[model samples]
Target: MTPRSSLAATAAALLILTPTPAQAAPAYPDPQPVTGQQIIHDPTVIRLRTGGYVAYSTGGVIGARLSRDRVHWKDSGNAFAEPPAWWYEYNDTGDPWAPDLSHRDGRYWLYYAVSSWGTNHSAIGVATSPSGLPGTWTDHGKVLTSETTDHWNAIDPAVIRADGRLWMTFGSYWTGIRMVELDASTGKAVQDATVHHLATRPDLPYAVEGPYIVRHGRYYYLFASYDACCSGVDSTYKIRVGRSTSVKGPYADSTGTPMLEGGGDLLLEGHGRFVGTGGQSVFKDRGEDWLAYHYYDAEDDGTPKLGLNRLSWKADGWPVVR
Candidate 1:
């Protein structure tokens, strides 16, 4: 063989063996922008068993909306035409607060809160339906509550199955987020399980609430909303997160600071037309992780509306919503 032919073969071999860098994953705000119906708060989204998507939020009888394509949404009435007769026991306002929706067995569970403002006297209730459609839920009565004598407010209920058990995370205002075990069959707390205290911001307005827990890879992430909400243009709510290896956590932020010590990694904050974005629930659909929440729209006269964003993981495994 000619000397030049030998050199050409060596060059071609090197070109074929040189590694090409893997393309960096897209950083969310997925070019497919999020658009939907207006007028929802503390929204929790779930894909239907048959098809389509549904979101439930805080408002009269727990407001609900529907999405045929998971992009466009329309008002689909509510869970109740009027507040349940029993709702007056904990709240006279007739509106329920942040709701957590989940499916198990052959039923859909919608857990919500009925409580007065600025008080720990609150109750968390659950209703179930075979299909998660508006006006089809049958109220199962109270799942948990707190009295003036208790330290934690029993609001903002989020449910997840982890470590082989159904667990609930709830609380607000007074003492921060708390969790308890749920009986898989009845959707109620386990008869003798302890109520585990999770995250808190006792020194900073004590404003953490709406705890959504999801398992990603090998870690369990707890997402919470922080600071003020419901003030319209003056709202200051934002989302934060922490993680633990165990379902019941000694959770810590990205920096290893304990969540109980006010440790939270910032996830989302107000920007541009979106103000006070918080009250989040995380879910996976079609292999993509999404953060669903409510935001005060500065452009819409500070009206609270639904907000959804794609969530991406960093190289180190922290979750970010863009």
Candidate 2:
């Protein structure tokens, strides 16, 4: 209990308890770098039942790809359904566009669009696989078709189930975002009231497609990519959003403005070597969320490719891939 001994003990205690000023909190979410596959487009990521990653995209001309990590990709090369012998248009861009996927009752369902830009002859088709990989698909025929340049048409297909109802939202140039009800068990359109627009456009991009619908918190967030996609460096793709209380319609942007009125908040724009990026699907993994999509890589010949980034939500309620 000497004075000198007590003084030494107090100094050591203060040294142990002292905190560094550099331990400040982050003002923004930390951006995570993506281990991207060069030129992979139309990214669709699924968390398998066994806690593995399965990503599909506009891969091989005849098949999809499977990947454990987001970076390395391998083509399954399994064709669940061959290009319908009926298909004749599209120049040569066959079996491309949005991929709507879900896992239900131990089975996986995939719906994709078949269309060429500027043509209303597009159709949305359904495919199923027991395992969420390629080649095991069962093409369930054409689920929906679009007007032949005469009407707002079907293109991008996005499906989500909420409130005891399964809904599919899709569209492009002709009208805009529209929805349809699907049988929970059979996965077929159930309601004749299938056609409904999700937004209003005074000057929104005419060829708006790539509709990805996800429910976050109490709001259903509809994120759609706008502008011309697949144009390499000249692409003008961007991500936009609208939220609604109902899974169905009347979704609005952050300003309480209807998405039809162009109320969506811009989530991402042209950045980095990627100029145009869209065709987004949000995925939840490892208790975190991510944005899976594609973009044109300007650094590498401005080729349209796949890009996956983690979607971090801000305090302000906007989502971004960092």
Candidate 3:
């Protein structure tokens, strides 16, 4: 196990992503020396309006890390000051969870969720960063919430503007992956009464969440991580993907089960030695594309740590997590 202490020299290194097959990927973040602890998970990256990159994570403490290069993130210090008080007032404990940052039109919108497991009392919200900084942030309040027993906990917020519409993808435990379009101005579900179910695990014995959707070529690839998370040293996470020609899909895996009806094309699995490695967030680095997420680094006493791996698509247009 490479102790965080052992990562001393590696921390300050100049880490940048260059196009490469996952196999030939470099050891992430060039050799540099820095100091700090990374206490976060399920990070989502957005290329800023000015073209800088800001990463928002599963912030239980309402904070994030900033990096000039994709690697070597420097903790930015309490980005949210503290969890919103209304989170408790409404009894919705999912506050300060996974956050996705983006600059749209002329403002920076931070979309996030609040919830707890085994409960349907969850909500998704957004706060605006007028100037895109820790202070001067404004809460847009809860954008949406789900109390449906079949929907599971409503957290892990990811967003994309596709097909001339703004859509949000999220889920956990029950009901698997769900998607809905948003009203451009309001940033709430379009309520055009359109919703799509992407995947579920009635057979896998665990939950599937952390969905990332993007269109490539003629395919809408739905990428997700499956299994249990938050169980220290004992997690069951793996990356998975499915594809369909339509944005909202009846996505199918290799064997051909529709993602809408609960199916996936396996992209990566936690090999026995790795145990649990999931809670993924995929983004385009300076190069083509890569995935940034937390994994139980076997070399680090199996402790969950940040990891970024460059990925490539197979000839058939499916993703392979190298």
For each candidate, the alpha-carbon lDDT, in order, equals: 0.87, 0.73, 0.69
TM-score of each: 0.88, 0.82, 0.80
Put down candidate 1 lDDT per residue, 1-322, tens digits, no spaces: 7999999999999999999889984332422345666788999999888999999999868888998888888888898778888788876767799988888899999999998888887899999998989989999888888899987889999999987888999989677999999888888887777889999984845889999998988999999999999999899998899999998999999899998989999888887778898989987788889899888888889999888888989888899776
The local lDDT score (0 to 100) that residue 15 gets in candidate 2 is 92
Off by over 4 Å in 3: 1-37, 49-52, 90-94, 148-152, 204-206, 271-275, 299-302
Prediction 2 global C-alpha lDDT: 0.73
Candidate 2 lDDT over residue span 100-197, tens digit each: 67788789988777777667787777777888776677777667777664456667788898998888888776657788887877777775645778
User: Residue 36 of model 1: what lDDT?
Assistant: 60
* Best-to-worst ranking by lDDT: 1, 2, 3
lDDT of 1 at 239: 87
Best by TM-score, which number? 1
| Better by TM-score, candidate 2 or 1 | 1
TM-score of 1: 0.88
Regions more than 4 Å wrong, model 2: 1-37, 59-63, 78-81, 86-94
Worst ten in a row by lDDT for model 1: 25-34
- The candidate with the higher lDDT, 1 or 3, is 1
